[model samples]
Structure formats: structure tokens, C-alpha cells
Target: MDFDDTPDEAAWRAEVRSFLEQHRGEHADARAWQATLYDAGYVGVAWPVPAGGRGGTPMQQAIVDQEMARLGLPALINLIGIGMCGPTVIVHGSDDQKQRYLKRLLRAEDLWCQLFSEPEAGSDLAGLRTRAVRDADGGWRVSGQKVWTTLAHLADYGILLTRTDPDVPKHRGLTMFVVDMMAPGVTVRPLRQMNGAAHFNEVFFDDVLIPDAERLGEVGEGWRVALTTLMSERLSLGGGGTAIGPKPETVARHVAEHIGALPADRQVLARQQLGRGYVAALGARYTGYRQLSKLSRGELPGPEASAGKLSGTRSARDLADLAVRVLGDDARVAASRDGDSTWQNAQAGLPGIAIAGGSDQVLRNIIGERVLGLPAEPRADKDVPFKESVA
Candidate 1:
């Protein structure tokens, strides 16, 4: 695959860089400043034009992501919405649904979260117990609890998966819906992580009513629709490393600079770890391009993408471990110590990824089955109903 960008893509990249420089000049408060990015049309670069995107190619999207990271822009908080939900809606939603949610989501006018994992099911997601029963008016009343829902407190809408038929086999009986976060019976309660941040939550749906029109696909076709969303979600999650664009190199430089400031005796193996981390971060940046190149050609890497996630996740964990070691007592600060620890939140949160979006073990299983073409693991409950499956 050609690594060089076409002249047109280069021009587009220049334009995006110019716009980001003018309106959002790498300021503090990176998270809140991301709205300016959406306003500038630089966000969601490769999403469809109909969905308020530039309709760029996957390669162009990768270019935008790299540039955004280069600028140290606050990472967009509407990841679930733009990266997962928006794509799913474009692919599966009725035209009206697309028109209603896509642009708003891209513009960050509405934030969204995923309501897939339930109290009973995570890796074995097909066994989720959230129930959605049809109502007299043809709407559905959803009742159950979803755990590990990221950014649920700030979400305006969520993509919900519920078990519509328990008698059917696990994967054959579910449905997907777009639920309003403020609906009467919906409740979001923050679940704090070790990092002292409550970014994810437990979402309760107690008779939450959703119009049939909001359903993503036909009943029992939820898993199919969900696969599209999940695939996109996994792809998005794995695309870039936890360090993101230029942040790793910056951290490496910072580590070196700080080491020079300390007494000669204090600089130790910690500096070497930082140097290695910087190289890994650069490797991740290039790996993102490789994935984008394949995706640009309409190819899905599937298990290969898991390698990116594993690399990114491992680097994050390592960097965090290194930061605490390198920064010494400085890591105790509530805020990042010289941006080297900005990823502390992510570092603290890495375990969630290992377990959340397809756990490490689960991704290994995918690699074994899909990439290696190995014999599948034996499972007696493969065909069982959702309710009948052992927890």
C-alpha cells in the first residue's frame, strides 16, 4: 500500500492544520476545547458528508487524527457517539434516523454512550439480560441495568442492546435501540475508578420507553446490528495508541529534560524506559496508518486490529508504570506532572480495556479463531438461551 498521501489529501491535511491553528491553538482544557474542533469541521473527517463529515477516506481520517494529536488538542469526548454510534446509524438506521442523529453527534451537539454490557454479561455479551418488552402503543419498555457505560452521565442518547426473546438462542433474540438519556425511567450513576475519576457508570433502565422508530434494526437482528457497531467500536478503540499522536515523544523529551534537572546519581534505568516508550509510541502512530490503509481499501483487519489495541494498551500500562517511577514523588499530584502523566487517567483505566471492549483473553480468542484459523474453544452454552446460560 502507498504510504505517501495524494496531493489532494495533503492539501486537506494542510487545511485542517490551518483551521485548528487558527481557532483552537493547543490551549489548556483540551476536553472542553474539542467543541471548537467539531465546529471547525476537522472532527469526524472520514464520516459521510451526509452525516456532517468531510466524507474523506480512511487514510485522510488517519491524517486528521495524527494532526489532532500533533496539536495536543483535547481528545474528543464524544468517542462512543461519533466513532461507534454515528457509524452504526449511518449503516443501519433509517434515513430519518440518520438525519436525526448523525450530524448532531458529529458536531458534539449530543453526547452518547454504549448500553451493551449488562450486570450479567460482558465478554459473553450475547447473554445480556436487559429486557425490552413491546408496549400497547408499539413502543418498548426497557428494564435492566448496564454496567461500565463510559460517559453515561454526559450522554444525551445511548445505543442500547436488550434481550427481546429469551426462548431463542443467545445471539438470535436481541434488539438494539437509541434511548434518550433523560427519559423518565433512565438513571445514570457514576462508578469511580482507581484514578479518582468517574468516567464510566452503571445505567439503569426502569421501564424506559423508546419509540419503535428508534430501534436500529428488525427485532432479533440486534446482534447483527450490534456487530456492526461493535466492529466499528473495536476498530476505533484500536486505531491509535493510548499516547495518541505526538504525546509520547513529548513525554520522552520531558522525562529526559527532568532527568537532567535531577542530580546525576538520580538518573537511572527510568530514563531508558522513557526512551523505549517514545519509540513504541512512534511505532503505534505508524501502525495506525497501516490499519487505515487497509481500511481505505475496504479491508477489515479483524484480529490484526487487536494487535494495535494490545500494543496501545500495553504501552499505556507501561508508560503509566514508568511515569510513577520516573516522576518519583511528583506522581502524587492530582493533576499531571508536566504532561508526562496526562495519561495517568488512561493508565489507571487500561485494565478496563483489557476487560471491557473484548477482554485481552477474548481478543486472543478472536486471534486464535480468525487469524490463526485454529480450532474453536469448546462451549456447551453456545446455543443456549440467554436466561439459561450460567453466569
Candidate 2:
């Protein structure tokens, strides 16, 4: 596919750049900036017009993302809402659900978190044990714990996955819902990481009541709806060049600046590692373009999302390691004395990227089975009921 923007795409890029230039300083607050983007129709370029989006092509969306990143603009604070939840809702939600959630979501009026992972069910997400039981009032009462939920403490709403029927196979017994984060019986506690940040949280639902109208898709179809969210998530996380953290170019610059100070014997090896990291990053970026090509053609992202994420996170982690290597002993001293923990934090935090969207082993299995059309792996529990399988 041609990398150059077509005439229309070039014009759209110009329009986006102009808007950013004019309002760059006007909205310092992240939510205000996102609301500005919503009013300007830049929030959901790939979404349908009827769904409160711009009705534009995915290329337009990419252009907007590119421009915003280039300018170092404040990121849209409701990334989980706009990037994952809104798209999932558009695909699986009822008209009333769309009308109630889309506009507020786009305008950053309500932040959203995803409640999919549990202590025992992260990589084996289909094995989650969160339960939602039918209530006497045509609603449901949920009880479970979700761990590693990003931004759950601050979110106003969440897209939750729960087991509705344990008698069925694990994947078949699932259900999805739109849940209020602050509702009674719901609690969120942050998980402190090694980097001294609590960006992730553990959330609990103690028989939280959810009205029937808040259900996302039909009961027992939550796995399908969740696939939509997961696909979008992998795409976002794998989109290279600063999606995970510092850009490859930025890392390379740091290496170049500090490598000369190293002993001549060490300089050669550092330069070689820098080149390797930069090339891997470029590969990830092109992989992102491949996913964008699918989106441009109106097709949903496929297993290639896993490939991109797997490679991108690995590249980011490698580059971070290279940066610290070039800095040598100063990496630790600067971090402790000067509070310059940029590279140190990145080094500590990027390993979780491999685990967050999906584990490296899980992603490889997806690519092997789906992309390569390899023979499937044996699954002893494939046909067993969830409850029986657990027993």
C-alpha cells in the first residue's frame, strides 16, 4: 500500500494541524482538550457518523494521531473509553445504549475502565470466575474481583465481563455489562508497582446491582463482545513510536549522546545495539501500518494485532535496556540523586507491557494458530462445563 497520503488525506492532515496549532494552549486540562477534540470531530474519526463520530476513514484517524503525537499534545485522558469501550459498544450495543454512552464518552464527560482481568484469569481470560446472578427485579447482582484494572479508581463507568452460566463451556457462559464505578458495593484499590506508581487497580463488586437494561450483548455472548475490546486494545498498545513509552528515535538520541563517554571498546557494542533497537521499532511501525490498512478497508483488526503488540513491546523494552546500558552506572546515580528517572522508570515499567495486552507466549500462540494456520493445540477443557472443569 502507498504510504503517502492521498490528496484528501493530505488535506485532512492540514486541517488537523491547523486546529491543533490554534488551540494548543487553550485546553491545558486533559478532559478539556478531549472535549475540544470531540467538538472538532477528531475524537472518533473511524466510527460511523450516526454513532457520534466523523464518519471518516481510518487513515484520517491515523493522521490525527500522528499530528497530535508530533506536537507532543496532551493525550486524550479517556483513551480506554474512546479507544476500546466506545468501539465495542458501537458494534454490540442497542440504540438506547449508544445514545446514552457515546456522546458522553467522546466528550470525556465519563471516563471508562475495562473490567476483564482477575487474579486467576488474566492470560486465560475465558477462565474468569466473576459471577452475575439474575435478580428478582429483572436486573443482576454481580460479585467478583478484577485485578490490574487501569484507571478504575478514577473512572465513572466500566465494561465488565462476568460468568452468567457456569454450566456451559467457559467461553460460552460469559456476559458483558456497562457498570457504574461508584455504585454501592463497588470498591477500587490501587496496586502499587515497583516503579512507585499505582496506575493499575484491583476492583471488587459485592453483589452490585445492575439493571437489565445495562447489559451489553445477549447473555452468553460476552466472549464475542470482549474480543472486540481486546482487538482494539492490542492495536492501540502495539501502535509503535511512543505508544508504549519513549520513541525509538528518542532512545537512539540518548544513546548517541552518552555512548561516546563510554570506553572505546564498549562504544562499538552500544552503537550496534542502538541500531538493532531502532530497526525493530521501525518494523513495529510498519506492522502498525498493516493493521491500519485493514482498518482503512473497513475490516476489523485480526490476529496480526497480537504480532504487532508482541514485537512492539519487546522493542520498547529492548530500547529501554539499551538506554540504561549506554548510561552505565550514571543511570542509577542520576535516578537517585537528580530524580531523573525517565529511562529508569521506562526500564521498570515496559516489562509489564508484554503482560498487559497479552502475554508474549499467548500472543505467539495466537499468531501461530490464526496467522500461520498451524494445527491447533490440545485443550482438555474445551468441551467441559466451567464448573465441572474447575472441579
TM-scores of all predicted structures = 0.88, 0.95
Provide the clash count, candidate 2.
0
- Candidate 2: clashing pairs of residues: none
How many clashing pairs per prediction, in order? 1, 0
The sequence of per-residue lDDT tens digits that candidate 2 reaches over residues 10-126 is 799899999999888876788888988999989988789888998887778878988999988867899999889999999999999999999999999999999999999998999
Global fold similarity of model 1 (TM-score): 0.88
Q: Which stretches of candidate 2 lie above 4 Å from their native place?
A: 240-243, 294-303
Global Cα lDDT for candidate 2: 0.87
Q: Which stretches of candidate 1 lie over 4 Å from their true place?
A: 25-40, 240-246, 260-268, 275-279, 295-302, 333-346
Q: For model 1, how does the per-residue alpha-carbon lDDT over 165-191 read when each residue is reduced to its tens digit? A: 988889999999999999999989999
